[model samples]
Target: MKKVALVSLISIFIAITVLSGCSSNNTSENTSKVENTATNDASTNQTKTNDTAVTNETTTEQGVPEKYDPPIEMTTVGVNYPTVKFSEGESRTDNVWTRAYLDKFGIKLNYKWVVDDTQLEQKTNLMLSTGEIPDFMNVTDIQFKQLYDAGLIEDLTDVYEKYASESVKRMMTAGGPIAMDSAKFNGRLMGIPYTMSNKEVADVIFIRQDWMDKLGLPAPKSMQDVLAISEAFTTKDPDGNGKADTFGLAADKGMTMLNGFINGYHAYRDLWIKDSTGNLVYSDIQPEMRAALQALQGMYKSKQLDQEFSVKEFAKVSESLAASKVGILYYPPYGGSYPLQSVRDNNPSSDWTAYPLPSIDSTPAAPQVGASTNGYWVVKKGYEHPEAILKIMDFWIKTFYENKSREVMEKYVTTPDGNTPWLLSAIFSYEGFFNVDVQQDIKAVIEGSKKFDDINPIAQDTYTKVMNFVERKDEKFWGFDEVYGLHGARAITKEVYLANNLFTENQFYSTATQTMGVKMATLQKMRDVAFTKIITGAPIEEFDQFVESWNKSGGEQITKEVNDWYKSK
Candidate 1:
């Protein structure tokens, strides 16, 4: 699930982990990030120019890898996702993608064993503990370090330089050096990072417009308005049920959507932000967070916030949304596609739309973005062709990302069975905001500013889905239109938050600090408990006590270690 994006629009998580806010246009287009440590000066689109210098048996004169005469065979692990259906005679080993790897690059991709995508990490982890691994595979950040520390991985700095395509290099650097640099240790590239869009995780407010129209309320321009709408939806019978049976907002035990409301107060949970004194500090413990918790406390007491939120999961919240028992929601860009669109399905008159976050006061709320790069593609030590993975990756980017073609989409990317086979590829990497780029394409086509004929196959597919909803009133494609539609979540995210620079990326992009590994899980659980207590009507002073407890319980050491890492950078 970690590499979910390589398969779908998310269809958006990132938190690299499905993760999930924002405010004003025009006033806020530069990303409101804290001090970013990346200074990677790698030339954009860095390319090798030896068009006529045919190298040895493994590479072409143009600096890209050419097919080997005997074929370079590598043993690796693979994921067999249930959603990926092969042609009648094709299996994971014989699919269009795997066949192309051998036919085009002369690489024999042998799967040592295959498992469900969910079990890939467990299988990989088992292999690592046993002191053996496939020729190449993806691993978590922590696992990457373990492999490196044990001298079980290859250094890909030179391998990337020699074998990577121009497009691959560009994708790696597109989001800046952090994504690529996260793979580096002692200035050596250990793996190829899977980069994603922070904006994809940034949530927005999704409200039922029919409910708002019924209440004669103005759309939210501030957090105050949001609260009022919440109150009205909960109290004024917005659903016209004549029963006080609705919740003002959707929430869950994980606090997924509610965090958007919390982020509006300028408090970012699970992020290390820079303070006025130029030191990195954890965000959840800040004073601003206390204020936000107090607000939730009031909402909970008033029954505006879901009373059962403490017991419900995101799936439960989605059920509430579909049942029309909830009005306003804060979720990732994919909310419409998942929970919100279901509301319309159950009730044809219901319409859910996306809006940017509103400020709490004079200052705009900057949507908190977590680190987008998580998994890394690494090769085992002493593999005969460590660079083979790069050739496969280069093909993926060109065929699926750069100028995607309908022929490839039908034959290789998406199958006639309505399945995705690209996820079956041996390695995965992507432009962080590639989908947002597609959003622009769809937007341009709708505006008639760009010819629909010029858009890539991916965007063309999106256009068809959107038009299906717009023209035929198709409930099946409702979520599709909700995201790529004229005022879809991505549209607001790109046209407003991005264009106005109302979002901020987390400052701590490096791997976990030493203290993080030992204490982070416990500290996270403790913080969630404290926040939950406060949001459920505990005394506001409970936050101060919680802060004191956190400081004494290794939080102080973690902060120091975090700052040490930041300062070293």
Candidate 2:
């Protein structure tokens, strides 16, 4: 009995030990499975995160993404025009304009150097000679050609097509193919042309309405009317000062009689116009130019023009206008804000008005205006990112015109003096950037669909000025009254544009021809001397000799080259 009981206990103890070993094996297997599951879950999560990151990067690289991931640093040289003013603690590199580029596009515009407008060409040439070209820079037509000849600038054809925004493309073609054509060399786009609106070049006759009122003369509608008005302004003592101290017309040494006077006689100087033979003829040599010169000579003889005008520079002429020594002038629409502004500020009672150039006979004068391609923006060769420049331009147009963001307006457009600053960017704007806007605002104001506050910020400032002047809220707003108020200069420009009376210059040569490049300065000097001499009592027959001499000295070659270029286009 005792032996049987001991065997039972031993058997029980062995069974219990076997059960515990089995339980231990099960726990180990469960622990291994859990560890494997956690590892797989972590791996899956990491893979998903990486895929999302790659997708975001791809999206940014593909379309017109507003920002970059890693960010890009672009270097450029900018022109610091004397007219450009910065607030305290702001600079070309640290201003709102530069910061906007960085914040929006991840582009850090580091200026390699900045120089005033006067020194831009000189400094740029020096940079080119030393092979230290910045990433991008604005260059004149001649400088653009020079860079092209040296193969130092990139051909932007492909990049522009691929990356340019739709708005930019539309604006580039706004003035027809001329703006784009100016930037193309041999079929490749080497630079982006900065164009002025066609309306900007349309010349207008600016005269003192007060003087006309004083003399009881009608607004000029013809060359004869203009002559009569000029005589009356000069001899009638329209200023009521009772002295022969004022001249009928204001002219600078560079452009005699201004563009309006020349256009009034149906004559154009330094422009290309179609002749009766349907070929382009240089206007300086045209017969109508001689007739205009004869008219100017007669005016000089009658003391209707400034006697010492030949020696007066633009500044001197502007001073004369401010001092109330001149009553009539010819200028563009914006002239109201410039030299004419001085006139208004000096004599608050002076009322200046703008009119289309008077007719020579029954036909009204259609003044010839050319697209002012001031310069171009170009990228240096071998730059890693040529599209960056286009991107910058895209932002500019959108900010100013398309987006019309209030933040941008407050930060960039508005000045401390409650005025608006003109384009403060390094890039050039499209032609007619604000013509349509101004017209729309003017219409809206007239129709009562929009208040001054509802218009664009820049236009709003203009509206404010116009209102202040019209309501006589401020005496200083007289210039604005003349320019933007009801029946102002802009009205005249808009009317001319709508009537299709504006004549654009036919020549589209972006750079000077080979012969012209060398001899143009000389030829222009000769023409100026001859024109001055003829106007200042020299023989009128000297013009024929001057034309002959001009044609002989490289003018014929230039004409041939120009025609060849036109034909190629």
Candidate 3:
């Protein structure tokens, strides 16, 4: 297990971050003193929270508002994943996170209703159509645009600057301009952008290292090596079952697994990159795409890929992975937590390794990531305390980043059973680069240049997971070690791709351009159908037809609009 760290590797390519700029040295008790100095109204010492409760004037001292004297109520909707579990006496409304909102801030969080995450969008749309929005809620970009256009959401421009902790402010700004701008419509900050780990969208090839060792094959260095290994994994029975039922690569109807392979041809899917003329151009329609599609079609014809890939969903493909019917997969860093975790669960000895996307020639294959902000936290326009949401958010950030400790983590963040109680909170937005940053901190710690306690809370949590898996061989923590340990997904992604400037991202981030809102869905659907046809059996010439049909059907106009936006920028 290569335990050496990436200190020199990172220092040569990435700038070092000063941790003290974000981490607060204040003890928990000191933080409490700063936060709990609220004026109380003796006339009403109420326990139950409601908007009508008597309270003194609200004030903020160092980005934290004083607790509501007589308690105040706020309403929101929630989604509970199937894995979410509560203690024997608790439910969605009375879990660890909700209790803290009340106990620490005297803020009662009432969920108008809870539903499975799958139904959240439909339920939210119905709620919006009926104009029954809660005081604060989590919303997608589409919902945010709808609410903003309808004048239904509060403006948080000043509220955010006042109540958001310094650490939180820095975290939000680190995502670059597009992330912060995503939550703004017409220059009003109507939503708190729900940022994601940027690396989460980039691709890394997850290969079955056990199969490679058994086949006596070296790690792939180029596109040719990948195809040759795929052939061997498909025909040589790497699983040793001897029945020829295994597959060389994992794929699905959505064609997501082919993303890395497509990149090998120096072509990107669903992104806008510059052409030789410095004009913004959609990548899928580029000439390079034909070669990638033809190669994929050849692989499909030869049975190197899953025969039913075009009909199976990614979930079904993951099931194939868990059943040991496939080997190679292309995924983001969190791949270890999903299909790769299934591999560990089904066979404890199974090993998968992350590798950088290989190239067809000397030029490296650049992985693509979309915009960072995926959702938003918004407040109703007329809410009495739009800043109340920010107050709660201040507590959440302080708990995890400022006054971090194992006791706090166990009591408030994650439970012993590995359940994250923090998800029960009404709102949460992570630092955009959290996961990648944690990998850097962990590497520094392991290299003896940093102390274990000095690393960020996220790194500490991942270290705990790695130690649990290493010392106890706990199956649940297996995925953590695969992604965050010394030689894991982050090592390849952070130390290789990102550090070396070998990754790309979409340039058109000004959400849904003029023609895009009117015609993009149909154009994207046309491309999907056409590409699928080409890869499944249609002649490679069909790609040319797709381009021609696409250009005639709104693609040309969208291209013009996009270039206009680019030129304006």
Candidate 4:
């Protein structure tokens, strides 16, 4: 019966894959054909192209060749996160994943150095400044721009076009052209962009359903409703602890309001939005922001917001949530797993549900979301085999997603402890990968064509946790249920996507402008201070003065530079 079930599941997946215009049978053969076509095309175009840098070098057509005639040595630098664990004898440079790369593609990875997450940016900056760049390294947008400007990184346009696997190309551009566009400078692709779905940034309001139920209030639909709820949550003692300690909202100094509370008033602080004339304007200085600040002032004065919020850090704020001291927060979809998970662990009775932000009036709240592309992969200017990076990425995508062989899945995909092996490959995947798959499986399950057990392992794990919560099998699985279950955070994101309510950041400048690079930090500090002061009861009039001061203190120049960059784009 188990074998039959496995075969049935594979058949279903194959059908789905075929419908998506991908072959589920013999991925290796398909990969080889793609590789051969790319290589032939590169050879044919080599003579006609004007790029003198690329020579007519004979290259293997196989995406992951059995072995190179002579093994290729590549050096890179990566963050060795503290949480990453190695097996008994495996090290960063010779781990199971790295060894697989060597065995499959004849690529030997040598780490110039592995730094902790804290030191990655500083050390990479130092390396770039001193011209000690490795063969390939992951770099921030600013560093990528700097390297392109300095002519220290290879123009990967031709190499990537010739060598990247079709699956990779599709995945990189799946979200939109923005991912690839961000990596381009002057119409030439300089780096491999780390792509993520724009939907990942969609903001939602997470409220304690139990608290609402206790107070006999409906889910909020307008700013007025939210305010009334806040007032009630603050005064009614919904936690039932018989103490007047609970508040309405959670906030931290790092991000004063997580999803930009000002967005509820159609004001996006620290973001760029278009005015009625379609001219780009900074959100912080707008009149809408003044109204938002005034509203926050009212909340603070009414004791609906935390009085000590200005001084609270993220950990402290999360602790307050875990202790049931706060009942509302604006956060991204992933909040179900992190701080909210801790809340479930601490107070199992708490029930959180996500809702779209309430509008100030009849106009729906369109919150401004931002990009999630953290970094990119770039090869040194003179690396002999820039395509090696793409080849490694091809291997990762194939092994991680397409490979259905049980042996490969059990050995390479999962660790000995039955956890997913963190690939940390130098490639980006669509942020919506798992959620999109889960959503599809959900539809299939609803239609009686699939079961939760038939989904991918990660989704299956999530399903198990959700079932555990729904069936009351475990209290700890409540967070998983809230995040990955049928009516969870992912569902809310899907709704936002379907409703066309998601708004992306207008600014696509990958790096800071000249004036912005120098003045942005100081300006942000000033903005934070002004916002905190205004929220904590400094006269609301102070916001106008701060706006005036901002323009004078390089804000005008920065705005001009940003607009100039936008026009160039």
- Highest-TM-score candidate: 1
Please, what is the whole-model Cα lDDT of each candidate in the order they appear? 0.71, 0.66, 0.69, 0.65
- lDDT of candidate 3 over 1-569, digit per residue (tens): 00001111111111111110111112111101011001111111122233112112123545444777688899998776554577899998898778877876788999998876557677888899988799988776677778888999999998887677566677677656666776776677888876544543377888889999999999999989889888888999998887888888778787767788888899988888999999999999999899999989988888888878888876687789899888888876657655578788898778988888999999988877655655788899989888788777666666544443445544555444545555565666555455676677777766778777676444665665665677788787777677667776867767887678676777776657777898889988999999989888999999999999988988888998999877766
RMSD, one per candidate, in order = 8.0, 25.9, 11.3, 12.0
Cα error, candidate 2, residue 243 (Å): 3.8
Which residue pairs collide in model 3, if any?
Answer: none
Question: Runs in model 1 with CA error above 4 Å?
Answer: 1-65, 87-89
Q: What is candidate 4's TM-score against the reference?
A: 0.82
Per-candidate clashes, comma-separated? 8, 0, 0, 0
Model 1 lDDT tens row, 268-379: 7778888999998999899889888998898889899888788887667777888999988877666676666678889989988788888788888888766656578889
TM-score of 2: 0.81
True-vs-predicted CA distance for residue 461, candidate 4, Å: 1.5
- Sorted on lDDT, best first, the list reads 1, 3, 2, 4
TM per model?
0.87, 0.81, 0.77, 0.82
Question: Which stretches of model 2 miss by more than 4 angstroms?
Answer: 1-64, 80-95, 417-426, 430-436
lDDT of 2: 0.66
Ranking by TM-score: 1, 4, 2, 3
Residue-wise C-alpha lDDT for candidate 4, range 27-132, written one tens digit per residue: 1110010000000010111112221111112134555454664889999876554434667887788776787667666888989887665566677778889987
> Which has the higher TM-score value, candidate number 1 or candidate number 3?
1
